[model samples]
Target: MAKTIFITGASRGFGKLWAEALLQRGDKVVATARDLSTLDDLVNKYGDNILPLQLDVNDRAADFAAISKAKEHFGSIDVLINNAGYGLFGSIEETTEQEAREQMETNFFGLLWLSQAVLPVMREQGQGHIIQLSSVLGLVTLPVLGIYNASKFAVEGLSETLAAEVKGFGINVSLIEPNGFATDWAGASAAQTTAMPEYDAVRAAFQAGLTDDIFGVPEATTDAVLKLIDSENPPLRLFLGKYAQPWVKQTYEGRAAEWDSWSEIANAAHGK
Candidate 1:
């Protein structure tokens, strides 16, 4: 059976990779990019199997309209992949108001609005899947990726709550937490803040963490994504790449230890 899927940020990176995989497997994809021309190759190759739309995603009205159009074109949306987001590189002090807003607008609010738009359609259909493109950064933190980290943390919370709310409607929500991949995510697709001198050492530490070995080949993720989409019971959070788990494991372990360490004080502070 073929699925009717809608995906954002389909011009390149994980979005383009996943779109091609779905189309090749006979799924109908409503793919969106800021510039429709960016999707020309997919349109030409996939024919009517792909619907290319021009979407900035930050425009709530446009996103809702795009979702509605996709619903109409495909009859029912079986899956919605919210992959339209970029990385913002800056420490908390180095980041400006505009940059922070832009980060949240694209990564958090855009995904929120799109998810809301598709929910009604999924409700009508009685089943659907919403896969969000989060990052391993959502679960942990890095020095200079502060704003980017916050945006994904927002996404993780949002998707988790959405899953609980929509489970009764048979709509599944999943967060795809990818580790660093050789995608434009941190390259051409990324935005950077004007570096402040105070954070130079912090930036150096961040740079040191981003070794060549941490990034997986972007195309290598397609198979896992396809498997997730096809799953009868997909996970609420699916981690892509082997690099994500160990770090997340360490993060959780450290968190548990700190919480346990504070248990006495935590209990003592409870005046009640």
Candidate 2:
């Protein structure tokens, strides 16, 4: 059976690729982008299977409105892929107040608004899935991507809590944590802060890690995404690339070790 999937940030990158894949497989898609013109190709190719809407996820009312439009058009929304977010490149010190606020606005609050809007509709239908686009950085810190990391970390917590809260209602929540992908995430989609003299070395080390071989192609993830959508028992979290699991494993191990080292202090603080 074909499903109705709503995806944000579908102008390009993984969002667009996934939208195309879904439509190709005969799924109805509500694709949203800030610039609707960029989605003309999808509109032309998929016709009624795809509905491209102009949306800036940061707007709470507009977010709800988009969800309403999609529900009215498609009858019921089966899934929502909250992929409307961008990277903010800057260390903690280099980041400006405006940049940090904007990052949270789009990445965190936007997802929140959409989730809220879809809940009543999904509750009425008695089944729906909410997929959040997080990152490996949500599991660990990376210099210069502090704001981006914070946004994803916030998403991680929000989605985890949402999953638990909505489980009994027959609504599902999932987080897609992808490592570096050959999308425009780090290119045209990214916003950068002014470089600081002290952070030059930090930036260099970060830049050095971003090599050609590290990124996975956007199209390679189509099969996994399709399976996830069609799943009877979907996971609360899904890692998209080869690097995500290994990298997150190491980060969690280190975190566990550090917590163990402080166990005595932690126990004492909790008041035995």
Q: Write the residue-wise lDDT of candidate 2 on 1-272 in tens digits.
A: 99999999998988998999999989999999989998899888989899889999999999999999999998999999999999999889988999999999999999999999999999999999999999988888888999999999999999999999999999999899998999889999999999889989989999999888789988899899889899999999999999999999998999999999999999999875
In candidate 2, how many Å is residue 53 off?
A: 1.0
Q: Show where candidate 1 strays beyond 4 Å.
A: none
Candidate 2 residue pairs in clash (backbone atoms < 3 Å): none
Q: Which ten residues in a row have the lowest lDDT in candidate 2?
A: 134-143
Local accuracy of candidate 1 as per-residue lDDT tens digits, 1-272? 99999999999988988999999989999999999998999899999999999998999999899999998887989999999999888888988999999999999999999999999999998999999999999999888889999999999999999999999999999999999888888889999999999989988887888889999998888888998989999999999888899999998999999999999999999987
My TM-score estimates for the predictions, one after another, are 0.98, 0.98
**lDDT of candidates 1 onward, in order:** 0.93, 0.93
Q: Tell me how candidate 2 scores on lDDT.
A: 0.93
